[model samples]
Target: RTNDAVKTKDAFRNQAARLGFGTPNLLEATEYPLTRLTQNWQLLNSLYRSHWIIRRIIDVVPGDMLKNWIKITSQMPPDALKRFDSQVR
Candidate 1:
């Protein structure tokens, strides 16, 4: 929870074991952990961008999505925001 690396490692290992990789520990399951994190990041980033574009088009998106987007904006660290904004502009 809350960006805890140990939890991240454990979840990564467990998921990999389910997929039959049988990695015995975090070090062994390195790729599995990265794959899982990357997959989730892709999903969240895509949904965020897609809904953002759609909302601009129609001037509306669900209230919940808008709220979550606003919260996510603050959740992003300053360096991350600057890097992202640089790409945008």
Candidate 2:
């Protein structure tokens, strides 16, 4: 799971770099996706802490197009995508 998180973060950061958004801060960026992609869903399913995840998404993700990033990562499952959609909107 941690490996999944790292891969997701790397892919996201690389895309951001390609789009001239700059890479995510290594120290700060890892934890958010790291925790989210672990398949635990405990934090993702929460009400209050979900804010943190959303904020992280805003901070780390580049540009307005989010679905691109989701697709690029190829790490999020359908259920996770649904949760992300609801949380994002």
Which residue pairs come into collision in candidate 2? none
Deviation (Å) of 53 in candidate 1: 30
Candidate 1: where is the Cα deviation over 4 Å? 1-72
Which stretches in model 2 have alpha-carbon errors above 4 Å?
A: 1-72
Best by lDDT: 1
Task: Report the number of clashing residue pairs per model.
Answer: 0, 0
TM-score of each: 0.19, 0.19
lDDT of 2 by residue, 3-59 (tens): 554334343335644432464455545554344454756755563365876767755
Per-residue CA lDDT of candidate 1, range 23-84, in tens?
45556556642345446867766666789774464445455455544323578889998888
Residue 2 local lDDT, model 2: 55
Q: Residue 24 error for model 1, in Å?
A: 84
